[model samples]
Target: MKNSFIFLFLLYSTILFSQKTTDYLLDKKEISQRELNSLSNFPIYKAYEFSDKGGVYNLVLGENQQKITKKDTLNTKIKAICAMNDHGGFLEKWSINDLLEAYEPKETNIWFWTKYCTLKDLDGDGYIEPIIVYGSKTEYGEVRRVKIITVYKNKKYVIRAVECDLDYCRSFKKDAAWNTLPQKVKTYVDQLVIKLRKEQNLLLKDG
Candidate 1:
């Protein structure tokens, strides 16, 4: 029994250590970057299912997807995945461009944007930096946004979201409780970098 238990533990550890976190987005299973870019310009792009309840339907800049709307028959049945799972899902059929514009109040009821990441050696290290965007909407209609960047010794994922209104919206940018942009973003980015480094460390140790 002791030998059997030891063998099983070793097997589990081996499998766990062997797992590598590859880029799921760029993996061989899905469409290529060039194809995705081209499809983003399509008038009505098919939504790709990332998880069971989430997928993304791409659309052209000036066009719209009639299938994506508040009154659509399939709205309740489909979960429109954000470009990245780290980002959040949508609530209403706001204008795509509006949400895609900027992180502001007036930009509500339109589109969503996630291109505000700033990459620099924030820690004064001699290495290129990486930061990414993440945003989401809960079932209760609260918005969660996070920006993350990271390096070796430190990591974090600043996260913030709350029920929004006219009063809250105006103060969203400056409010400490509701805004998680710089801090949470930094956290998540750091987490990813640490994870990548750990994976590399394991690979090198094995090699």
Candidate 2:
């Protein structure tokens, strides 16, 4: 009995020490420029195909698309994840400087998307003060619901994103090591959050 017990313990330990393997495979999907230009709150499958389009392809449509209702808006808060960052993503490369400039309608690019969020001023403030997130599933990966908050500042609605899925965050890792387990897979959630907050605060202050 003692010998059998020792063998079982060693076996169990070996299994425990073994490295974990992931099933996540690199999805080769292409994104298009036209799709990117017309992107809203509709989920796209095979986002890798449209990756060139950039930004999350997932969108929230229908009544949810019209305007973020009050109930859903309240649930948009990050809740206990403040240490990391807010879910609404960040602005694109070109838009960063534009956002810093004075808020204006022409300056607002509805197509602009960031890991932090898609912003809009529903009430039509020169500034995109409202934060919102799109909640839905995409063809290539999981999709998150949209969070819309209407901040009553300057007698207009400011749109901003409050939440989005961390799983959707991904980037291309070129190194051979990144292709294997443990090294390649990392959540852009934290980085996205930081970037989003930094931009969010900046936009808010200016708006």
Please, what's the RMSD in Å of model 1?
Answer: 16.1
For residues 43-150, what per-residue lDDT tens digits would candidate 1 score against the true structure? 322333221112222212222332355642111111122243224433322212212224443222222222433334443333223333333333333342322222
TM-score of 1: 0.26
Candidate 1 backbone clash number: 21
The digit string of per-residue lDDT tens for model 2 on 148-203 reads 22222212122333123233332212223322222111123224434645764321
- State in Å the error of residue 61, model 2: 7.5
Predicted model with the maximum lDDT:
1
* Top TM-score hit: 1
Q: Which ten residues in a row have the lowest lDDT in candidate 2?
A: 76-85
Candidate 2 global TM-score: 0.19
